[model samples]
Target chain A: MPDAGSRTASIGLEGGRAVTARPTAGAPRSVRATAARIAGDWLPAVPLLILAVLLLVLPTAVVVLQSFRGETGGITLANWAETLSRKSDRRAIATSLELGALVGTISLLIGAPLAWAISRALPAARTAWLSLLNVGANFGGIGLAFAYTAVLGTYGMVTLALQRLGLPFTPPPSTSFTGLAMAYFYTNIPLFILLTLPAMHTVRDDWMEAAEVCSATRFQFWRHVGIPILTPFLLAGWVLIFTWTVGIYGLAYALAGSAPAAPVRLMTLQIGIALNQSANGQQRAAVMAAILLIIATVSLVTYRIILRRATRWFS
Target chain B: MVFVGRLGRGALFAALAIYLLLPLSAVLLSSFATTWTANPLPDGYTLASWGEALANPRLQAAVARTFGLAAAVLVLDILLVVPAVYWQRVRNPRIRVVTELCAAIPFVLPFIVIAFGILKLTGFAIPSLLGTPPLLLLGHAAIAFPFLYWSVDGAMAAANVVKLNEAAQMCGATPLQTLRHIIVPNIGPGLATGGMLVFATSFGEFALVQVLVGARFENVSLYSLDLLTRTSADFGTLAVLTVLTFIVLFVISTGVVWSNRGKRGTAVAGARAMTAEKDA
Candidate 1:
């Protein structure tokens, strides 16, 4: 093929005695070659580098800086101190963390089996399920809050049905912490399925068959091999979802109006009801945003580590 | 044992179906219902709510603006990411790690936090740009960048873009021509899928839009939030609007899945590129 011919020719030219065709050291041609090499290496990366600095790095720096600045314009730890000391702020942080953990765990438990089933199903069924999951995964934010309300709110369809059936139980209102967690789970379970589906395909059927030939029972094979291989992916998914839930504001804000979560609290303090009600509300919100940034950074680092481990199996 | 296994599988399918369809059916039914309060089924069915939703000028504007903004974001992301990814793949492989980390930043951080940072930064750094559609566009592009980059990167790898580039250049094709004829057509599926996914995501995005531009701009998600928040909020109308949003998303996703149907093998190969990305 023409492709193979060029590749071989280039390799041969590099490998063979071609020193005489090259420019001498310290000559203008060598200088030009060096310049060309440097341009080739870094020029294409410039646009991305600029975008990263402007969009990601600089804003992050601004948050960090604002978190330390007080009303008087000098640097101070007062914002951090007040954020930590305030009972309401501390509770919001705790609630956010607890919600993230709860949602992450629930989604993983529900999604793993579905991912396994989808992977092992017929091709047509797999495609259908995968597409459905993709839709659900993307179906989040305000629309999700509305759907949940229609299903489980005070006058919701299911809630009313249960009321008529004399079940003596009503689901929580769509604004409570528990309700918010349920809504988060609705979207994220599908997200977990989508994220893990690709990873699950890496589990080879031959590996399972080989274990069977070695007298390993299905349970034993799964316990020793399947679970081990799936652990990193599950952990990565958990962390990703956890971070996702932590940063969420629209659903909680839309459903609950004002919930005791870090994101909602930050919004309230920044520009909502809490804004300008206090002298330092803006600074406090900045501090809280910075704290959330820290939590996100930690989650990302853990995700990267788990992804590294997961990629080993993938490769 | 086989019977038990079949029973388990059957139960799993039942759960999956219920989980996927229940909320959707609720939304669909409520949209057409005249009144659905405190009843197992709606008391009456009507298209009045759908008409009311469609008749509202704000809702109409919201739909138009949502598509416009999403389209702009998609174009900007493709333009910015394709070259960076192409260059990284073809010229400087060493910078892959830095670019990947940059792309992953938005995925790791919450949109709320990113919005907060952008809001504060723009307030001081570029006050003129604040509360504009362009700012929101920038935010959407940043958030959607990773998806676009990864999809195109995977497709590029699957297409053996490096070899194709080399061959094209040896045949005296310029870089621009190579990109136009070789790279774009080969990675058409990835570009389409990425574009559609970004469009769907931006259409549904709320936090950034709510924080960055608020009511100055109205997207579908924000419009839905507005309806729900009003004291005299109409559930039927909200339901209709929700269904409309779902239909648009459903259509786009169907296109993506349909385009992906016969190309399953290449899709797997594309996914492997992401795995290789992590290894770097």
Candidate 2:
């Protein structure tokens, strides 16, 4: 109570009341401060909070509700059952995972080394490279797709260059799923580099120096020290890239010929097709279920990982 | 020791740099080429693409509309969110936890799902909020709120709100007066950075606009998409437009990064002043 009144009196004093305050006066000022703090902090969160929850909950609920209902009124799991049994739907799921995994792996292989090189370079060089990588990293989806089309499309320069070089210029499979994966991997490399740059700072020259002094081989040093220290960052970055690649539609949409050919047509694309085809309720329900499943799984996993990691600082 | 490895490192970094810059360079090249059929190199060079893209009246109008919508969304979001976040920060931990979780949903939920929900719920309403520019702005603001919230919240967290408020009260300033006189000026950098970020994102966004508004109102990105897909492929015009977009994004992103860094530096000094004033 005394603490509270002192805070209140302090408010009174600062507001130019020009009066000396007792311990009792601080209590009300503290209460008012607490009130003001709450008002300021929580108010801005409302719109986002409301929108996020609705977005997370609503479509999903609708999906689940619709997926079960028959053409008439009987509640059944037939839609979900059908989603799995249907060859096209099954292929869609497989394609999404395969493309995501491929992209994630390739990007990691290329990006990690680049990140290491940049981190170990001179400060000026590192800053310039990092800035370039930042732009490239963000230049994904539509922008990258467009660029690749110009550079590697049927009439792309790369295709032409290969022809002039007297090499077998087979258009580099630009329209295929493989080409799409390559594009995704290219974009992911910059992002991977950016994510791991912060963690790479943890690897100091002194540590490398000690390793060299000890006469450890380069591979040995990486295996024993570098990998272990960077495991958390690597895992975190990989998971993000993996999930992002899974949900990507733009790159695949732009490059792939159609719903069937695209290697990574997502549930959302399926929903789009259904909506366009006038499948109506079933399409909505299907989208709801797939998105709900995705959101729930991702949120749960990310939350658990982040929570465990966060507690390490305190421990 | 680092000097010994400098040559190898420089070569490596240079390769990485080429990878990042090449695609952009290619786009620029294709745009300027007067005759760049499926040839390995351009046959000639000209400024026709730039003229072609700019000459179209619709494309010009869409660019203007996009800028207007971005500005409006930036202002509307800041005005609405500041009050909400400011109040939440003052409240108890329980309230803060719930609110923070809510704000994070938009980021986690993909644009596809959000578009579906918006279209479903607001389908019949006209000016057809989902299909109109204003509707797009509203959807954008909803999606953009979290970025602004975090930026401002981080700024406020750096600032000592409790002390600032109490000090203002002691100086005979009311709640409204304290917010305007003390808090707003101090957090101006955060506000500006957040606004710039929102503008950059909304300006560049393609998915939401494509789905929500369809072709009812086209932004630059959409226009580019249409140009690529339709008619004779005009590589030159796209290249010019892309270069223009890249420059705009670079400038906006630079402003946000610079302002946020400046705000971070000022936060400590601002905190000290608030504490000093409180003690006095």
The lDDT leader among the candidates is 1
lDDT (tens digit, per residue) of candidate 1 on B120-228: 8889889999889999998888787777776787578768787888789889998779888999999998898778877876877876798789889988888888788
Candidate 1 off by > 4 Å: A1-48, A258-280, B1-4, B262-280
Docking class of 1: acceptable
A1-315 per-residue lDDT for model 1 (tens digits): 122123334433432332333456566666677897677666766766776767777777887898899798999999999888998788778888888899999888887877777768888778777767756765667778888988888777788888899987679767567788888888888877776776676667999899989999988888899888888877877887888888777777777754444333433224333321344477777887788788988987787667666666543
Best by TM-score: 1
On the 0 to 100 scale, the lDDT of residue B52 in model 2 is 86
What lDDT score goes with residue A197 in model 2?
A: 62
**Candidate 2: what lDDT?**
0.63
Please report the candidate that would top DockQ against the real structure. 1
Report the Cα RMSD per candidate: 5.2, 7.4
Residue by residue across A126-224, what tens digits does model 2's lDDT show?
658757776775566556677887778777778788877898867545456677777787778877776666556566678888999999977788889
